[model samples]
Every structure is written in structure tokens, then in C-alpha cells.
Target: MDRPEKLLTTAQAAEHLGISRGTLARYARDGLLKPTLKLPTGHLRWSLEDLRRQMRELREQGGE
Candidate 1:
């Protein structure tokens, strides 16, 4: 059996990615990123692993 992955809140994810919460939300809105989970109440959650991958991609792209 595999353990469940712990998802992070928007603010936490933003901090980990070294970006503002607004920028993180904007990235999600613009389709540059997507929340790993969204509750029925509209709360968003992100995967830290995904954020790291995003950071790597951004660095590779020179943040263009």
C-alpha cells in the first residue's frame, strides 16, 4: 500500500516556489500551473513535487 501525498496550501506552495500567492494563483488561472486538488468548498492545494518541477522548468526557461 502506498501512503498518500500531503498537499500544500496556496500560500505554502507560493513560498516554496519563491513567488507571491497572487502569482501562484495567476499561474493557475493562466494554465501555467494547476492545483493538485480543489475541494468542493473551493480551497486549492498543490503538490510540492510539482512546484519543484515547475521551478526547474522556469529556471530552464530563464523565467521567460
Candidate 2:
């Protein structure tokens, strides 16, 4: 059996990325970062791996 990928809430994702929650939301809205899931309560969740990948890509591109 395989373990499921870790999922992060918006705030958690923002903190992990060292960014403000609003900035994270803006990134999602702008399509810079996409949410892995949306709950019925309208909350967004992101994959930890995906976030890390995006951070690496941003670092490589010289984006802060």
C-alpha cells in the first residue's frame, strides 16, 4: 500500500512558501500556483510536492 501525498491548506502552503496568505491566494488566482483540491466549504488545498516543485522552478528562474 502506498501513502497518500501530503496536502496543505492555504495558510500552511503560504507559510511553507514563506509568503503571505493573500499572496498565495493571488498566485492561485493568477494561475501561477494551482490548487490540488477545493473542498465543498470553498477552501483550497495544495500538494506539498507540487509546492516544492514550484518553489524550485521559481528559484531557478530568479523569481522571488
Backbone collisions counted per model: 0, 0
Model 1 whole-model lDDT (C-alpha atoms): 0.84
User: Against the true structure, what is each candidate's TM-score?
Assistant: 0.76, 0.77
RMSD of each: 2.0, 1.8
Where does model 1 exceed 4 Å of error? 58-64
Clashes by residue pair, model 2: none
User: Which 10-residue window in model 2 sums to the lowest lDDT?
Assistant: 55-64
Query: lDDT by residue for model 1 over 1-64, one digit each (tens)?
Result: 9998899999999998788999988888877777899889887899999778876787698773
Q: Which stretches of candidate 2 lie over 4 Å from their true place?
A: 58-64
The residue pairs that clash in candidate 1, if any, are none
Tell me the TM-score of model 2. 0.77
* Residue 51 in model 1: lDDT: 75
Residues 1-64, candidate 2: write the lDDT tens digits: 9999889999998898788999988877887777899899989999978888887887798876
